[model samples]
Target: MSVPGAMIRCMDLTRFFADVDAQPWADLHHAYGSAADIPDCLRALAGESEEAASEAISELYGSILHQGSVYGATARAVPYLARLAGAGYRTEDLLVLLGGIAEGGADEGDSEEAACRAAVVGQLPLILAKADAEDPGLRRAAAWAAAMTGAAEQVLPVLRLRRKTETDPGVRAELLGAMAHLDPPGTAADATAAIGAHEPAEVRIVALLACVDGGLPWGPAHHAAMLSLLPVNDLVEGRLDLERNEPLQYVVEELLRRDTDADRDAAYTLLDGALRSADSEARAEALWAAETACLLSRSAPERLAGAVEAMVADPADAPAAYSLLAKLGVRAAAAAPVLARLAAGEGDPADRALEALVAVAPDRAAPLLARDLGRRPRALGAACGFLFGGAAGASFTYDPELLDAIRTRLAEAGGPGADEVVRLVNLLGAWGSRASAALPELSAVLSLCPGAVPKALVAICPPEHRGTTAELLTAAARTGPEEGRLAAAAAVRELTGETGPLRAAVAARLTPGGPAVREAASLAAGLGPEAVALVPALRSALSDRAGDRNIPQMDADVEIAAALWRITGDPEEAVPVLAGVLAEVQPMWLRWTFGRAARAAARIGGAARPLVPALEGLLTEPMQIPSAVLALHAIAPETLDGPRTAGLLLDAAEQDADAETALDALVVLGPDSLTEDGRRRLIALAERDLRVRASGLEPGIAPADERLREQAREAARTPAKP
Candidate 1:
């Protein structure tokens, strides 16, 4: 009869009473018959007289509890009897029955419940005796049962049997699988000893698979077994089959898919080998898997430090190495000396290493680059370029003393690094707000290197230097060759305002023949009222043929759009212009330009309202999601209500879902709504789904849905664990 879940104790008692009138003697006893069928005949009686049925069942269970203590059959059934007795029966009676079962009579061994209890309390002697019983069935049951009871003492017996006549392959495999459930300290050593005692390849494979499944710390024995398994053969295939059994496959797959510290660290050294397999899809899968592991490990300081160490040791992986260093950020301070050493080298890898170093320890790295200021100018130029390159520049800031030191270095006698010095000058103009004292020195350098100065002056020279810089830039653009005039025009176009000096400078650069003249005129047209005089010139450039570097249409678009917005006080003019160019735009700069235009429209009232729905749709794209969410957050944070967002989150948390995107969305949505009941449900979901999704992830990086399982564990604890 099926027990109703409403109250197991009450139902069991009721079943026993209903069967009292004509209790079947259990005459049809198979080796292991179901204990359930006996109560069937009393089903009608049980419904009519519930109290009478309960009493009869209780009495039967009590008698069974008594029988279980003194007979072999009862010993096998004692755990169930004990459970029945404990449901509503007296606690003292249950304890007494348990004691009697443990102190078995001459014929019967300890009851299974008593043996399991003994295992739980570290009484290994009792379990060892049962495991060495004359009957193989009893030995197997005891060994396996004790394993489930979390006893470590049976590990040795399991190993010893493998060494003896382990003739039955299935029996031997079962024993190895059982060993995987044990977590004792010396289990690996015991498995290794068994492997050594048996010279057969099957035995060795079983031993190695046992060690892997054990998931213990890697000791000498584990190392030996792994090395032996490295060479693939029939034996290796067999061993891998054992390791990839349903349970282990699930565990390894779950571990490989998450971004957890343990998952990342464990797989770091294995991924490269997986990638180099002669399989293209395998290489892609392995690369992505390892990348997932690294992302998960980013928050772990120790793992991040380890990754930095690996990068230093292997400079050949410069791109991957640099990206890892960037992820480490300031936490990788320990890698500073290594970065300094690498920056001192001349190889291209050395340049990459320096960039990675600067990314992590920018303040410290600036000094190293500064100390080697007089080294190879090409390397120096590359270093300075990386320091301020659009890609790596935002990753760091110049410490005050470091910028000062660079300024002082620029004042020193010149060399092949002069181009780099000019680059630094441009950086100061762009970001050197605190380097006011260096302006005189910058002006001196510009004057001394007139040709070099104007090339970068628009980006470097401040307004105080603008008038003088403009004079120099204008004179150079008019008097020098095509390149010099382009540099001058580019410099003068950076300063905004419709002042007399700016107008004169733009006029001088717009002599109307070269690309330099057209670019200057286009920029002048966009510089608001300052560029109103260049309307005719800008229109003329739009019709002119393109050159290698000039963008006549784009330049004219930006200029005309800027001038129209300033003159008419309308932001819509810029939106349509950008919208027209959207299809042909590259991702690298498109969104940034669009964002700027949108922000400008926002400032000029609701000119950007029409684009809100378009921006909202971008939230589902992986790369664009963050920006879209941020924009929405700014516009309407309250729209992400608990019920709606939590439902979205739950959908993402499903096993078939995209885990990385789910995690990202969860981080944005927040977990405020994951209440106690919700957590319990999540745990139940994880338990149901873990078997399927476990194979796709790394071991340590389990799904967030599993948090419910962790909560269930916490709830069931009595005193509560720390």
Candidate 2:
């Protein structure tokens, strides 16, 4: 394009040059006449003539030994070419060309080479100084260049400062990306300390990644501080708090990998804190976190003993107790004294103490476990299992005194502890398989105690004990209040594999009218299609009032769906029933059923297609079976591809009260649906959602749904090529 009405026309053009042609400079030779007339060629290169511009550029390239030839002329052209570098360039080539002037004086030591380097560097400084620019792209480019030029001292310090003060998140994030590639230009530790102080989540996150990759030492004290900071509500400002500062996440992992006392102690502290955190993810994380702690502690018998002492002293450190006992499982004999003392303790820590020893007491530890089963009355069902695992049979002699003490507790006025004794006897009957010995005492507890004891007996009792327990359950399953019936049904599910009499006892309880009876029936159905007889009762229970109060019934419906899906492979059996429940059920329960149905249906392969309409309807409502959409998306993404699907999503986005719900619909519709009008609407909704999330006032339900939608969108965009 040429400038209009100018004495010397200035034109800007883009073209490629190749050396493969015989007369590679044909255009230049044809325009400028010869290579000797370089001055006129340089003037014409700035003019509108394309041929002159080519010759001028080529002559400038050829002059390696001159005071002021085409090289110096182009040196004055450096500012003009800098914009091209900012746009996009073969950056390494550009850097090398610039470096030749700055470092090597590559133009044969001519003053022009010096002048060219000065001019390029002068232009480059403007770009470098703007690394802290408010514009994200400019800041990103500047930071990239600064990194490329080895901005160890000057650029890093400015980037670090701007990382703290910059308000524009994108700019801050880009600067951080640039900052991560460069060393901090001092002691690695000092550099980490400097960058770690930056503010806002974007920069701090990058700084953390950098610090982690930079190989900083993260010992016990460092890791403990980080663990304290978890369950973070704010990522940036929250990090600045000394309480929130921890060794970097990667550093902690590396510490775990190394064999050292510092690592072991840090791992122990982290596991203790993680297990106690209110967050479920954190709790789950704590389980694996102990692996290295266990290894590094080298099954230390003394340390295990110390942990027991600490637990006994504090009484509040439950995780520490569990950790100590779990670790002791590896030190079977060394743990005997601690387990015996804990099993015998009659003090405030007694309940906790028993819980600790139940799993750790060895095969020979069975005697200790068995002794406690009769004398120390707490968590009896658990104690029975310990006895079974420890001393498996009639081989171990039982103390009559201990058995008598249990019988006395059962006969006396019962507190919560008395019930614990009955549960213990049931456990013994279940595992010991000696129903003949305990039947009298077990029947008495079933007849006299609160309903829970008998129900537990039904669950734990072995095939031999099932005979009497089944008789008890059948007689009482229908007669008790709703709670008793549900309890009876749960027990029936547990005893499903016992003798014919017990199986029949469970079958008889799968009756109509009561949610408890139906729930038990559903559970029975799950055991096998033999209990498919219970399906009629389950189908009828679906008509029962579906509300928050009917949690058991909702639970029964899912079990019924799963049961039906398992037996018939009929989407017909589950879909209509599940859809009916979805239509009338409480939101939470409905969500639960939808998720179950979707999973079950998906497991049955394309047999789930009929349920897609219902799943889609719930998905449109946001958080209403969100997991189901993923199943549908996986099985039938094409269903969401049509215009009708787009229209439905758009309608949902507009009509829904929750911004997240609408955002999710837009995301499902995908970027292809973003016409100018649609784009504007989405942007507006996004801004509103952002504000709501920022203020902590919006419900996360819809936003969480949008996150799922975002994940789906990203998955769809990834190409198949490796």
Candidate 3:
């Protein structure tokens, strides 16, 4: 076992572990608790068998560099790993592991991450020597490892030297990528130079990306270089471990990073050509890039929708095409004709086609959906208009045919699965009293699917049927499963304002260790003063912090606080809990918990004055603006800078970053707070054909945009009082 091109003598295997026993392994930690087992994993890497060494490296990755996270033990293991590679003990695998550790880097001011990088840097000599190894695989691995060191000064020169003689296009691509990573500006000209016709397709693909990464001007050469390499999958053959495996998608991402209209146009151009390509592979790659492009560029949905429609024309490609169209929402209305034709047919493809149709043109989709009910579960789920638990948009238009289909599906003996039952019932619930015809079917399923049926019954039953509905709900609440019982109690309360059933059910589920504590807290909040008797149970559950709860602890606390406020109207009990959540939650928590806490605090009115600073702090965050504004308006309207708040909301609206929330906030502020320019902007937003809420890659963008536009129009029409 000797190194082929070793510049430094490889240390003995025994000596590699000379100091291993001296380290306080038990005191150190990796991703999963103590580092005591790390010594065995390190020694296993030095084993003679490849299978054992492979497993050992994988185990080490899971522990030390778990999911790109580095730990104290990660730095300690670097020296032994370097020695193993230097000694030619699974050098390729060890180099890859070392590279991953280097790339994971460290958090700011984390000595361990810095130490891990420094440790890799310390072994630069042995690692760089392998860049010239005879095995192209080893050399490729070495290039990647060397680049990960971030010692551009040392690694770049060696990589450039290797580039002069490297024959493998895969290795050369890795080298170009490494150099680009080390210094994008310095490597831009080199990257551009490699895009010539003479370079292998693999090298040119990477060089083209380097130019994009370096912010080199997009011109004829770069454009031609990219177009010529359409469907780069064949040339690269998945050999190069590029960040994004698909070259076209990688290019779109890099182009979008520039985030200019010109860059977007450039991406659209590439996708358009590929979409029109006779080559199926090229079109397939374009489809992936199109989804990414549509989500990112405001102009993309219009530009790519036609090309995507063209892709949808192929039966083999229709499923994926329908998925992207669904995500584009109403932006893909132009494809409705094609979707309807396919949806008119049979089987999974038609079902998928109908699902997209429902998303983009629910009216067009409704008749087709009604015709195909009971068979197309996914399309029906789309028609239900709720994703997970949040309302995505308005449900499909009420149609006699569709209503009849739902009733038929519900009435069949041993009918749809629990999920389908839930979806059908939800659609009925969305229709309210118009779906009164389904009441018998809803009542029949109460015993079987009580969680969904009770709520739907509450919505569909008219005034005359309320007594019977409440009686049915009361019986279910008393006898059904925990989930069903809770839902029944809630419906009963909603119908008759009856506190007994709800209180009894809520009290049973409000125990500290109960599975439905969050649900119970929510129902308790809805009860308001009617739920006063449950205040003690709610308080106890607030501090429960049960580890197995479905919702986050902070979320449960916010719910309990809101419940306490509604039940007892005690600001002291609620304000501090809401404030603490606002103060302690991280930025990632802003999506739900922070907004929820702010809205909860808003309910306390002036009594929530203590939470004003916390709510104000959230004003700076784009996503939190709506909840914060609404809260501040309720709690302390006098302290707000109306013009500044208006400006922030307007900016968010124009950018579509948090447009819906911003628009809602503006509506609440009314026309009086708006400047003349703000009013003009609002009118422009309402009249604009392009969406105001088109930023996310989710499925409901089109409907959400329309909803925003309608709201904007309403806000603009609100007269300013003299």
Candidate 4:
């Protein structure tokens, strides 16, 4: 077959390096293992089928850049890969690989990333030429790659020109985005001008965001303008992507900004009408606005209660409404009767309603909960589901008699013969050490509920029962599936602070293995420094294993990296891997990504400074903002002084979802970092926190806000301390 421009370019790439078939790949290392497979992966991309190309890209991503950390082989491969990209063979995937590789290896763990990025950047012109390629997809991808790898100064002009001539809205958006990356506008006027310019919503939105990224002022006018761009038809039909919600979210956050009374009142009016809107999108967004207002005490909580409860009537909408209600705490007490009635119904609404009701109307909910618990022996599973179903349920005050009755019921129920029995047993397990009274009952069903049983036993056992718990854990470890065994290992480690017996199991599981490796890695992670002996094994597990035909869980490398950090106390060893994991996971923003790896990096204290960049990447994610800021402040306090980080925290504190976490990070920054804009941000955060408390919510974490405020003040007074 006659080679296309892409394959010819790829053929030229071979000259930049050893023949793919000739390279001694086994000696060269990647995240998972040797680099030998990389050549195969590289060759696989030259194949005709998309599947082969995709598989090759996937393998490359997994091995060379597992999660996000770059390996030695990755750096070696970039120049040749860039040539392939320049030639336009599998350009999008190549760019993705290049981008991922470029984002990594800045740390000691993955030392090759920096060199690889520089090499790739050196090939910028070839990749940039694709911006003018006849293929629009390649043009779009090339623009993104420029943003990801190429110099902003060199790429910006090209992007601007492309924006002028681009007919494709998507391509235009990408150009504007790439431009934004190069020199984002840095003032309210520039942002307004950029957004108000003749451009598609995607381009305009990117421009506004770029302005924020550029440390621009974003005030009520900007807020109002962003919201105004939301065409009504799109909102009602849910035609817009998740990105479109960013502007609406900003409007909701307008309450937290230091704005005029007129703006505040106008925002309230705008939000209130939206709250009343029948369209789910509008109402949902309005509810978010109302929650922030309520939390800030800028708007009355009651104003949004009816809308929330009405929204809750639909099962699909209930989870979100219940989440707000959970935040509302007792402020939504007036909705208690409504919640209780809803809980009496069935499925998700019942579970969420019960959880929310327990928070707002505990006294009112107790009887309803008691009724459900005793309603029928078969209803026991659903009843347990109601109590332990949502996150808020952990805080629910259980009636002593009901607890006693459930224990008694479980004792009489014997082994879990049904799915419901397994669930009930799991709930009893979740009750933890406080529910130790149910241990005997739980142990009886150990075989039936292998996964939950050992965890429960270890969690709930008294100090006196530690040996007994260890015994049971060992037994479970020997008897259950890989997950069950790991769970048992983690549990036993917790109680005994010993890893000797589990070391063999850990080594056996933490290898080039299957899906079960994830569970094993998680257990090792949870074991903390106690699993020190498994460090080498963990490192081996993290290596590329393309030869192995096993599908590991997503972010498996992250868990192993986190465990390595916790166990070894070696930031140089752990931080880069954690950062890599963060790089890999942050773009996805999965709820689970905020788990051990991020926490490990945060707790590693000052030595995890290398991870600051990775942590900062997550600052834009509302769910991740708190963790990101907290990690930043803990690892490198001085870094946040720069506008972008501080501005991000300030923005985070403005939102209801992230307020507590944002405040937590601010407090951690102490008074020194809290002065000036930092001080104002902390003050606003404190005020918002106080408003949440004053709203009569549970105040579970916010009362600590004042203490945090005082700590900052103390730091201010001390001034002598660094």
Candidate 5:
């Protein structure tokens, strides 16, 4: 456990971490406050003693790098650990632990992460040599680590040789799964041999999953064969006792959908048995599989609906059935009649059923909900479910009669059920156009429910009624309930579209100790250029509220920065804060910052150049890439280079996932942006109509016309024309 031994072998460790004897413990962090104690754990892991090493690996596995997220001290710890693995460090899960660290820090786009992998790669020769260790365990561990570090080409040859002579079924199966990644010509054949191997059930399960993942999960016979071999220990992470929990038909239903050409007759035979089974687990899985996998036999929907209809008598089973039906949304329209009965039931069950009815068949359930709202204990929520609470629920607009019904109830149902009236009034505010006739009643609630009046009034009042709305909201912003005051201020700003009165209102609540700081900032953001008057207040609020999460729908810090930029028209004012957020070492959890920061950075131009390294690292993720790509070209257009950026723009355009940002990047990148290689691939992709701007409205696929040709024409307008 002496420091000199590890230091002598891996001298580069001193760059990021302290030595054991002189550890500056107070300054480091390892996802658990102050990592000063980490050096002892590292030393114990380095020692030759097995018991000490076991305890060390267990304690430090997640701490050094928590679930693939790296901390400051994580990179420093990698070299010493790699040295231990290279020098024959022993433990059953040591290779698994090391493999996590290697891949956890595998983000090569960032310098700190690149350094960790670089250190591991330097020790590859030593790690690879361990595959021939006298102990079979060490050899297995070494092979696992090599594959994780992408020494696949190097590791697979050694693994193949070991598989030929290895007697341990567990080790041989592990070798086959590892080899599946590189997928040389005959991986499917090798996987089949492993599946047919006389090994532990867990080992064979590993081989089946590897075969599927290796893109060779062939025909229906293999699909049924894999199902027959289900309930394996490794497949479910040793959590469920699959032998007792798994029913035969449930197994076949799960694996049926995963295969492209699974036998329909065999699948239906198992599913029919599952539907008839007494086991709820089997029956439910079969129903869900039929829906998700597009495996509707002629009788599937009727059998499923009839089963749900029968279950409506049992309150306990009905809600869950309704919830499962809701998973398919409008596709489960066949279950509407049954769902409506449950929606008319009592309490939580009714709420869930109402939600499911909206999802399953909004149009059919609409009149039922409209009539029931006046009588239910929570009428407002039922209305929300039909309005926009469930996915696709918004498309089911209220009938004018429904609006009149809600309006009449809002006024008549005032006194003891004022909260109900309040909720109805709030709905009227949000459904402005649909419920515009409900405004006179919303204004009437001003005296009835003063707390909910201001926002509702501002949000729903006719434009001619602005004078009355401004008066009500101004008073609410000054002295109403804390929740209503902020809502009032926001409504006032949005209603007036003039910042003077809204600014005065928000300013009254923008004090350091005030509860409306976040709302005030939001109002400031919406004010645009008019918010310049509140800069000092925003800056002060941001300082005191650095970690504040009170503001929903946006990150508080990012909003404050964005507000500052909009108000000042000075990129210098906001760029620093946006850059700081963009440059976070672990920005994965702070994804809310990506789009906000990217939009701000794209406006700031050269001010964002220094954060280029941080921005580039986000390219690995699909969700964050569009914004990151925008920030990249905004700061340094030259970094985008050739076809990859061009192709990404085309792909994002076709997908419409983040086409606006991609289109913006193309603009910053200028004309003739793609290199010849990118242009070639792009044209081919568009030829498949993958980059069509408008899907043909008339009928057949869109021809490679002007709109399609433009994608390959202007860099910004360039369709990825194939």
Candidate 6:
């Protein structure tokens, strides 16, 4: 268990075990409930059995440093771990754990995080001594652990000194990475020198990455060195840092960071060359880099599409190729032939290929989906459209083959799962009255799956079938599951505008402790003035503050408030609730509740004047601007400085920061509200080929970008005030 001729000696084991026992371990907290078990886990680390020690290390990682989150117990455990590492009890593993703890806390800046880092920093003298240990593993572990302390002044000098005497290629690579972590700019010269022809490939790979990390100019020599190291994964195996497992990806990401055409071209060239390599691992690595490039650069999808498509020819590479093609959207349309062949074939990856084919070319996928209707759930979901976020393949036009296939699936006994049934009904609903032929199957399944069927029935029901649909909905509203009842009631209202039979059901749902409070509030709001009787129930539900911090509860409150305003037209009763929600909710990015509250406030017009300051405050937020502008325009138009509002909209549009909202506001403001400069910007946005918005790596960015451009053109054509 001990190292021979060890320069760094262990702390006295007797005293270390005593110190560990003295600490109040039970009182500490980790990710899972309590840290009482942590003491036993720590004691096992010093035990004679290596298996016991490994298990203890894993246990500690799961608890105190769970997923890189340092807890109260994390700092207390650090001193013991550092001393054990110094004592040469599993020196490599202990140092790696200590390094993870140190780096985990470095960026978080909380007191617990600071204490964890400080605990490791206290053991620097012992850790640095191991940087030159006789064991290469100890040297590598010590170098990584020391750099993780982020104490550049103390750690960098030791790393630089070790770099000179390091003989093992892996250890040398570790030393180079450690120095680069401490100071990238300062290590640039060392990195450039190490990339010479004589250095080991492992060392050269790390050195090239260090050069890129330092923002050093990448010239012909660096390019030649990188090309010569194609399939460098094997060379740097078990040597490179965890983050740089895929070295080419790191290089291409750094190049793309420059955000210039030349840098992008360089990245594409490197990826293309790697893709053409005969090595499977090399092509796999390049595929990952190509995916990253496509996500970042506007030109990457087109430039790298052919290279990525070539990957599908290899059967092992087909799954990843399908996923990347799906993300590429319309940009990878050229791969449809290959994807179609894979989709039509029978294999585990066949469904994945169909899904990708659906995203890239829905017209081609529709018939295939139709031919294999009962089997492909994911492809069906893709074609039916995502509930959240923009997804392609929802643009499936009226194809008789597809409609007939869906109708056949619906009519079959025990055909699809509950989720698939929902997708099928939703797809039929989207087609509206044109899907009347499927109405008979929908009616038969109404009682079996009442929640989705009622809505679909209302959508596809012709004028002659309205009476029959209303009767079906009314029966379901009267006698079905709570969800079905609410859905049926809503559909009945849509079909016949009668809120009579569902009044008691809506009242019962608004009784504070129900699961369908939000749905009931929405249904009541649809009743408008006819929902006056449920106002007291709504007020009582709003007063229930049991789940006040819950996002869904807050959303229900907004819905109830909107229902109140719609029923009674009382600003005093509703605006305050709307304003309260606006104040309590935050981070408008994902929280649709804040936007919902704003829209409700806008609906009240000038009576929502009390929300003016809050709405005006929201004008500064890119995501909130459209809601704020619409509210301000409704509540108090004089408060809006047209020029300033126009400027903010333009800034949001150009940066793709909530460009959809910004464009909606511009269209609402009309042509006259825009300044001369703003008009010019709007026209330029419409004409530009490079997307002003929707430029992220998501599956539907291409379709989203096209929609934004079309919206911009519409805003440009909007007539000035008469």
lDDT value for model 6: 0.80
For candidate 3, the C-alpha RMSD (Å) to the true structure equals 4.5
lDDT of 5: 0.59
RMSD of each: 24.3, 24.5, 4.5, 12.1, 9.9, 4.5
Candidate 4 regions exceeding 4 Å error are 1-24, 105-110, 186-191, 228-278, 282-316, 374-395, 398-408, 411-722
Q: Write the per-residue lDDT of candidate 3 for residues 582-643, one digit (tens) a residue.
A: 76746564467888888888788999999988888887777778888989999999977776
Candidate 1: regions farther than 4 A off: 1-257, 260-297, 300-302, 306-330, 337-368, 376-414, 417-422, 426-441, 444-498, 501-531, 535-559, 570-722
Which wins on lDDT, candidate 2 or candidate 3? 3
TM-score of 1: 0.40
Error of 5 at 243 (Å): 22
Per-model CA lDDT versus the true structure: 0.46, 0.47, 0.80, 0.62, 0.59, 0.80
User: Model 5, poorest ten-residue lDDT window?
Assistant: 696-705
Model 2 per-residue lDDT tens digits across residues 156-246: 7777776676667546655555565566323345334534434444444444445544555544434444455453333433221122233
Query: TM-score rank, highest first?
Result: 3, 6, 5, 4, 2, 1
The runs of at least 3 residues in candidate 6 whose Cα sits more than 4 Å from the true structure, single-residue gaps closed, are 2-11, 21-28, 33-38, 107-110, 234-240, 312-320, 347-349, 386-393, 501-505, 546-549, 576-595, 602-722
> Would you estimate the TM-scores of all the predictions?
0.40, 0.42, 0.85, 0.55, 0.60, 0.85
Better of 1 and 4 by TM-score: 4
Candidate closer to the true structure by TM-score (higher is better), 3 or 5: 3
- Model 6 sits at a Cα RMSD from the real structure of 4.5
| Better-scoring candidate (TM-score), 2 or 6 | 6
